[model samples]
Target: MNRFRPVRTMVAAGTVLAAAGTAHSAWNSTALRTPPPDPPPVTEYVSLLMPVRNEAGRVGPALRSLLAQEHLPRAEVIVLDDQSTDDTGDVVRRLCGPYRHARVVRGTAPKPGSPGKAHACHQLASLARGSVLVFVDADVVLASHAVASSVALLRSTGLDLVSPFPRQAAEGPANRLVQPLLQWSWLTALPLRRAEASPRPALSAANGQFLVVDATALYGCGGFAAVTDEVLEDMALIRALKRAGGQGGIVDGSRIARCRMYDGWRDLREGYGKSLWTAFGSGGGAAAVCALLVWAYVVPPLAALRGSRWGAAGYVAAVTGRTLTARRTGGRCWPDALAHPVSVGLLVALTARSWLGHRRSTLTWKGRPLRGWH
Candidate 1:
């Protein structure tokens, strides 16, 4: 055990160094992503398309934020409130009725067996009128510059799609301890900047909470109806964009948008379980999440608990690595990374739940029962 300590420290340090370097690429390309393309010759029409189910509580604030965007355009806010049983209709009616650009289309029932959101988004897209269409979830509140930020990137880069990794708002013990996974998974696992940089469109990953698209491109590629059955429409859309040789990437969503992803631990567990299964899939789900936890969080802390100077130094570096990354990215809860063991344990539980969900085939979400795609 003593002999192996140095080797473990070196390997862990290398991992930290690697992640730090890879994540740093976003900062390098920031200026390029904000190119000065003289604000298009015309107003260049854009519409904000929001698809909601029972998000009455969240939709009001989200709509307000969308309306407040700075220099956005002659934009229209189209909220496709998917036939909710809640006060969703009244909520949209009050917020959208007064404003000319803000309008709500009450969604018709999905074809007997279709998922609610996919069908709702399809309806939203069909009704929207703009050169550029943005699909923002009702729960996500955009920062004043979010629309401009994504549009600028799209204009500068000429990509068919632009997805923002949402800024997740959380409180309480469970929320604080586990939210970093949402940020780090994309940063460490994917070569995100490289994907966005290249025009080849082979690289992929998109956050549906806030996704922007060229209207012609969206329809030319078959539209939201194309992914009406996908359990993870965001990732599915990313794949579709790639197969059609379109561009996709993540940005500093925290600066321009935020979302209370869940009410509490139970919602987080179930919601993420469903999402994790879609994102990570079954066979790789359990083992891969476990390995990441062990490597990134568990093992380093274990070395620190040994109560030796070298162990302390290694663990301190681990914490520093995570903290620095979090500080720069604005997407993760850095303090939560300190709750390594508990978070990893819960993550494993969720991973297990996801596997069980896939098998049982009753992984319901937002009032729709899930179907096993893989």
Candidate 2:
């Protein structure tokens, strides 16, 4: 056998695995079905909870969208103002004045060991009177039937929690390169149906931007307090819920909601730097994941430029998988998918910056220092 044959075989196998995963995700992925014209009456009460900090400029659309929700007669909207330096509280109060079902609560400083967002969520949970809770980010704008459709899916699937991932709205070049990776990461790497059926924490996936959870299971699993110090609290919360014998997973929510998470490259870098270090559990795991990404994505494209057949095949498979994921998740395909290797490189760079910040105790989000860095 040629000395480099094994290396080529490994590259080919990795590409094939990625292709298989993309195909499986596409085949089994579930979308939040549009509500029927006369949707069955919802009997369970729902609490639409929002946590905001320095979101004054953008919270209006999100609050408006929540207030305009249809088929949720027995629901209440609650916004927690997490001590924003901006007029977020005033903005929410003004918007809520016209809707009796909506109200704003001022949040206190988070106790030691608790992140601000988690503290706000915990406080909101305490005040909720509903059997179901839908946690939405201030940046996300929901469709009129988002809540109704999500609840229907939850009931139909018998899941304790479900994340309806919004269609990421990417603006500039930086966003075009990175935003698609949000859904593509899980879509290509995870088996969604299997994740829902399995209780293993490692098999779980979620997006907190528009998460719906059965309140009973949430409390039973310790709620946000269980993940108080977690940087990636959404994933941690799902893992905790699963560990408590509850089931949950992600679904396509592109048609029902959308969010633009970052403004540009600088904003995106800061947004990711604070939490990416904890994404893979530890420093070693982060390194391993980055290495695998480079090997499976970046290397093949480079070798393809040098006329290697296996390399060309691997690069094609990577692009094909990206295109499929984008099409499935309502992201920009075509030229964006062609830059898959560049996306992986940026992700690796962000991961490194995240680790550096973690080690130097420099991570922060929205003006609050991240605790539990040791």
Candidate 3:
């Protein structure tokens, strides 16, 4: 037994490496799905609803793109200024003045238990007049055919809701390093086809940056009002839609829509830190996720650097997965794929910050203190 110790060690290492490689392959194969095909003929009226607060500078280009939509003839654009302290309301009015169907709504203060953005979205949904509602973030710039393509996908697929995640336009170092992981996270973790078919909310994922939903289906799920206090309203809404027996899925909309979600490192940090705690369901879930991330992303690289051949293979597979996702989503590949360990480290830090803030009741966004998790 003493003489066979080396053999046992080798076997253990081999088993770990094999498991890692299998997991990597599973993730890589599912990383970048074929994007949905182009739009078929759809003449339905589409309403573009955006909720904004202190986004005076960013909202203009998004509005311009919405107004310039070519395929949808009877489209209307609605912008809800969620009690902005800046020139957001004025800017929206001035920019929308030229389009007859475009209008801006002044949002009232959120109720006692409601989250700000969710409340604003609810108001916009209440006022929407189209059968199809396309919720666009203030910073998202849509291609001329984006609305038509998205609506066509929803109609063609028979899904009640669809989040056409846009291509993230990362600027600063922090943005470039971290934002790509957004696309990669769901792309690798959740199998899109299975999520589309399953009604389990746990499997549901969505990006609120550019989401499309059937107005009636949204109403059937209690609308944004149902998720009024949810910090991750996108995920909450998707789960609600799924629980209501409605089907929806995410599609690669990198070619059709683009967004610069954060201006710099600080912006990116706070933006993510606000909701990271609740993102994983509970504290235990968050811990499990952290452990998995560290094991999957960090351990292999460290082991490789320490002279483990199996770790080297795992590292290669991990980088390959990141490269695949980046190429498909237009995210940076070179340094990011190589920097996976660093990215995981930063994410772990962010998660810790988020959890600490949640415990201390100090997590806030855009000047409002975040309410405790449900």
Return the top candidate by lDDT. Answer: 2
Q: Relative to the true structure, how large is the alpha-carbon lDDT of every model?
A: 0.70, 0.86, 0.82
Cα deviation at 266, candidate 2, in Å, is 1.2
Deviation (Å) of 129 in candidate 1 = 1.6
Q: Give the per-residue lDDT of model 2 (tens digit) for 139-256.
A: 9999888888889888877899989999999999889998898888888787777888688877889998999999999999999988877878899999999999999889888888
lDDT of 1 by residue, 1-374 (tens): 89976767755664564345434534433422332223443267788888888887778888888877666657888888787889988888888877887887888887543556778888888998889888998889987777877787777677778786776777777776677656655655556667764544335677889988888778876777888877677777667666666666676666678888887898887787666666554576557657766665556566667654444554555555445546545645355656645666677778778777877776777776667455
Task: Give candidate 2 misplaced runs (Cα > 4 Å).
Answer: 1-10, 30-38, 112-114
Per-prediction CA RMSD (Å) = 3.7, 2.0, 3.0
Weakest lDDT window of 10 consecutive positions for candidate 3: 28-37
State TM-scores per candidate: 0.85, 0.95, 0.92
Cα deviation of 135, candidate 3, in Å: 0.3
Give the per-residue Cα lDDT of candidate 1 at 223: 75
Ranked candidates, highest lDDT first: 2, 3, 1
Give every collision pair in model 1. Answer: 143-256
Supply candidate 3's per-residue lDDT for 81. 94
Clashing pairs counted in every model: 1, 0, 0
Q: What is the C-alpha lDDT profile of model 3 across 1-374, one tens digit per residue?
A: 69955644553454364355446435644543333456654588888999999998888899788888877878789999998999999999998999899999999898653448999999999999999999999999999888888888788778898888899999877887788888878766777778875888778888888999999999999999999889999999999988898988788789899999999988988998899998898999999888777776777677777776656766777787677778877778887788877887788888988898888877778777776554
